[model samples]
Target: MKQCWLDIRAAEGLKSVLCQEAIHRGFDAIVADDPADLAGLPPTVSRVLLPGKELPDAFGDADLVIVDPVQHGEPGRLAARHPGVRFGAHVDVTDADSLAVACASVTRDPVTVLRFADPTNIPLEIVLAAAADAHGLIVTTVERAADAPVFLGVLEHGPDGVMLAPSAPGEAGRLKDAVERRSPDLELTELTVTAITHAGMGERACVDTCTYLARDEGILVGSRAKALVLCVSETHPLPYMPTRPFRVNAGAIMSYTLADGEHTRYLSELRAGGTVLAVGADGRSRPVVVGRVKIETRPLLSIDAVAEGGEAVNVIVQDDWHVRILGPGGAVLNSTALQPGDRILGYLPRRERHVGYPIDELCYEQ
Candidate 1:
């Protein structure tokens, strides 16, 4: 997980409320310009003091003090003079010389706070690459809490932490959430096919995503929210058509597909710029952007499957040999060829859904 630091320097009257909320949200550190502002803060959060160019004579209860080596003294010498407090180097990267200095500080300083003058992430990417093997923490300052995700994803490894000077209340919590957002793997089950029938003409959805999906990757779709079948992507070879590596012939327009781990959305509700979970055969899942959803009238087939616990699941899709679902050990089974007693990969959600949000209540679907 990435570390989140709250900068309360310009919070004015809302400083106390922001600090309390930051601590409640388990923020890694609270940054302030005045030493007095760092006092009375709980030890649960690291107190980071970022003073002006001229260093203060006395340090209070600050856990870490960020300073410019050129303005104040060297970080090591400052640490020696103020043994009770830890020292970190701050750098403003505006040009090649400043970028080099920031890169050097990342390796030598125990903690390096960087402010990039350019809007582009090139400078920070260079610093991150330079600190690939460095043991220190690299905290990059962002203009807003919303920009934390972009910086946290730089070079894939990203910076060790991000510092945000929130403009208003509750921004710290938002920043914390952005820093800790992650997709978890699901436990897929092997469901046995119980029945199959021709459901006549209906609209089915073809989920086109912005990213190319792997052969083992696809989306989960079902008539009922409690149970869903793994629908494979169009990454495999088709006899008459070129491969559509970014498309998944999902299911009927009204079927439920996962928007994330905790939420589901109907295929009809999916639109361009929306997100859906792209799950792999091994149960790993990631969010992929929806480029578009193609809905067309076609002869539909209904598939009925049962989980290990005897839970019934249904998925309706276009009745064609080209449409496919996944089986155990990454086996691809054509939807038209499914038979009774055939085993396919599926997932059983614990609770029923209401408006896409999981809710613990009695709900039934056929």
Candidate 2:
């Protein structure tokens, strides 16, 4: 998990409220400019003192102190003088020279706070690469809490932590939530096909995503919000057209597909930049961004399946051999070839949905 450090140095008026919110949200640390701000904070959060150019003679209740190496003496000497508080290095990378300094600090410092002068993440990437073998925590300072996810995903192994000066109390919680965004592995159930029927012409959605989905991966679609089936991507070979590895011929516009672990959205609600869960036949899943959604009138086919637990699921998709669904062990079963007694991979959500969000209530969908 990426650590979140709430910087409360500028929010002097709302310091108390922000600090309490940070503690409630389980922030890893709280950074303040003055040692006095760290006095009343508990040990649940690491109290961090990020002083100005001048080093303070005493660090009151701060568990860690971040300082510029050039402004203060060597961190080693300072640690020896003040053994109670942990010392960290802060580096501002503006040029090649400062980038080199930042890289070196990340390798040795127990905690390294980096602030890049520009918007590009190349400097942070290079520093991260330099610290590949180092056993230290690298925290990048982001301008806003919303930018934490981008910096946290840099080079796939982003900064070990992110520090942000939130504008309000709720921003800290949002930062924590963003850093903790991860798709959970689903326990997919084998759904035996009970019926297959041809439906009249309807608008079918082809979800075009920004990611190249794997052969075993696709989106889950169904007529009801409580159940979904794995609709394979366009990675397989087609008879007349070339494969578009980033697309899935999902289903009718009214069908529900998983937006994440806990939410579902109608096919019509998806748009560019929206997210959908790409699930693999093995039950592993990840969130993928929708680049575009193509809806066209096509002959529709409806499939009804039932799980061992007596839960029924239905999916309405384009009635064509080229459009496919995933079976056990990633078996690509063409929609036109599917018959009664066929088994396919599917997921059964435990709760009903209200406007895309999951909620427990009495609900039924025919």
Candidate 3:
């Protein structure tokens, strides 16, 4: 399980509120400038001291110590000098060299506190790289609640913990919830092609997600509620047109999409600012914001498929060669060359959903 900490050293007026909330949320510890500041804290919650001038004489009583490598030398040496004392080096995320040093220092000390003072200029890629580099604990401090998911979702395995400050009230709980949520992963099964037909001209939905998608990543859409087909995005380079790595020419407007595994939404209902899951060929998924949804009248091709379990599904997509699907062994198959009996990757919902959440109820969609 991931860990979380609360920094209340500089919290003047909101110190008590933040400390109590941190205890309520089961944080690992509360970091303060002086150990006396955490006197009233619950016994279950550990206390961490950020010694300024010098090491405290009661260091053995404190659970953790945070220090700066530049001012106090290496944290590992400090820990070695004072036996039984655990120390964590404080690092600024903006400094590349400092970030690298901090990540490397994790080999000597098991914990590193990565601080991000500038919320507007939070370097997400650097933070992710640092987190990947650290073999031990990588704790971060963000300025806002919105930045929580970014740090928690950037890599397959994100940071081990985060330090919530008192700057944002009532945000620690929400940040904890976001970090605790499991990363998205898709379960794809084989669907045999049943039929392909020309469905004349219709409005097709071209979903442009906020994140840049890879060639193997796309959206899942189909006609049936239980079964859905993986529609590869427009990231593949074509002889006729340039690649749009951020766009997925999903399907006809009425087609159903597996928005976030539990919930299904119509392709036509998708609009800017809506959320969608970008699925890769390996079945791993990540949430993406809808940047734009383009609807255009174009010739359509209807694809019918059925699984071995007797489940049948269909989708009408733009009759263009650029639109593709994932076949057996993760091979890319163009829609224009699809034939009967060709196996393609698809998904089956475990249970029905209501308003984007799972519920124990019967529901159907045509």
Candidate 4:
């Protein structure tokens, strides 16, 4: 992988710097001066934009970055120093320590969250948004703010469980009380809210635009963890939109979800336990399959994907109508009822070095 850095200053300068960083690695110099500059950086490399303001210490260790403080995410200690680099919507992720402390207390084996919290512990919202969108979590925003309450994302399921953004802050307490007052499965953690929006932010251009994007990508920001949150892109693409991905109760989100184009290509191989999220303005759907769909999250098919630890690696073992994924240790992680025409996660296990099933019509680099 060619690590790089981008500097977004003036539109003209941005184009040049983005091109440079896409090709090299260096310190603060990017400045988002215009739309052209903002669009200068290459879309491939992991992006890290400077907030042009306050940044936290967590970003200090980034390998490649793009500077565009005007970006969304947040301002912190690390961002302050890396002036010009733009890592907007991708900031503010569940710190590995927090996630470890949170999830380890729950999962059977209890892996260390820190291990997953590398600078690339990816925003939980982004992952979730992608998943939810895949599962057909359609978009129909309330015309009025007072419309029937919509679940922001996370919900209190049990102890050390995922949190959904409450419509009102006090609603968290209400939800907490409801869980404590009614259910008795596990302890209740605080409600967490994901920021996933793209309504005219960046490129939407209007409310219709925002809805269009969500209809296309479920929630803009999400993660690949057991649960996915749909929230706005923290350090959004540009212009800025307020999106939010809710923290789903672990296991609350079963099946799969898809956002945008690439994730939707393959709907046939999904097992019943799959989900397909659709969060885009074209909520009704146009259904244009642009690329081939591959089920492996840990994409080993492409050298580029492998180097980036792109997707989870899973193998396809079909037994007539069913598909089973054998873990590296030779155990079935999960199975689903998804059938042809259904959208499911591209199931990939950690052990098998499988390439991927190909879609006949799409333009796949593979």
TM-score for each predicted model, relative to the true structure: 0.90, 0.91, 0.76, 0.16
Off by over 4 Å in 4: 1-260, 264-275, 279-281, 284-358, 361-366
Q: List the residue pairs that clash in candidate 3.
A: none
Best by TM-score: 2
Tens-digit per-residue lDDT, 1-366, candidate 3: 777787887788888888778888887888898878867676798788887867677763477788888788788888889888888788765666776766565555677777765554345446556556446677778666567766665565557777777675677777667667664687789999999999999999999998889878889988776788989888878999888889989999988886674678889888799888888888998778999999999999999998889887788899988889877666889998999999999988766666556677777665
lDDT of 1 at 153: 81
TM-score of 1: 0.90
> Which has the higher TM-score value, candidate number 1 or candidate number 3?
1
lDDT tens per residue, model 1, 1-366: 788898998999989999999999999999998999999999999999999977888778888999997778668889998767799999989999989888888888899999999899999889998998899999999888789989988997789899988888888888888888888899999999999999999899999999999999999999999899999999999999998999999999999999988899999999899999999999999999999999999999999999989899999999999999999999999999999999999998879899999998888787
TM-score of model 3 relative to the true fold? 0.76
* Tens digit of per-residue lDDT, candidate 2, span 1-366: 789898998996999999999999999999999999999898899999999989887899989999898778656678998877799999999999989888888888899999999999999999999999999899999887779889988998799999989787688888888888889999988999999999999999999999999999999999999889999999999889999999999999999999888889999999999999999999999999999999999999999999999999999999999999999999999998999999999999889999999898999899
Record all residue pairs in model 2 with backbone atoms less than 3 Å apart, i.e. clashing: none
Winner on lDDT between 2 and 4 is: 2
Per-residue lDDT of model 4, residues 1-366, tens digit only: 111123333234235533453344331223232333334344444333333454444444343332221243222333466674323222222464444332322222111011123333243333333333232111111112222122222221111221222233233333333223221111111112111121221111000122122212322111221122221211123134343222111111112223322242123322332333332222222221212223322211100012022432111221111122112222222223322222222222122111232234333122
Poorly placed runs, candidate 1 (over 4 Å):
73-85, 360-362
After superposition, candidate 3 runs with Cα above 4 Å error = 1-3, 8-28, 32-47, 51-55, 68-81, 89-114, 122-138, 151-160, 166-171
Could you tell me which 10 consecutive residues in candidate 2 have the lowest summed lDDT? 69-78
TM-score head-to-head 1 vs 4, winner: 1
* lDDT winner, 2 or 3: 2
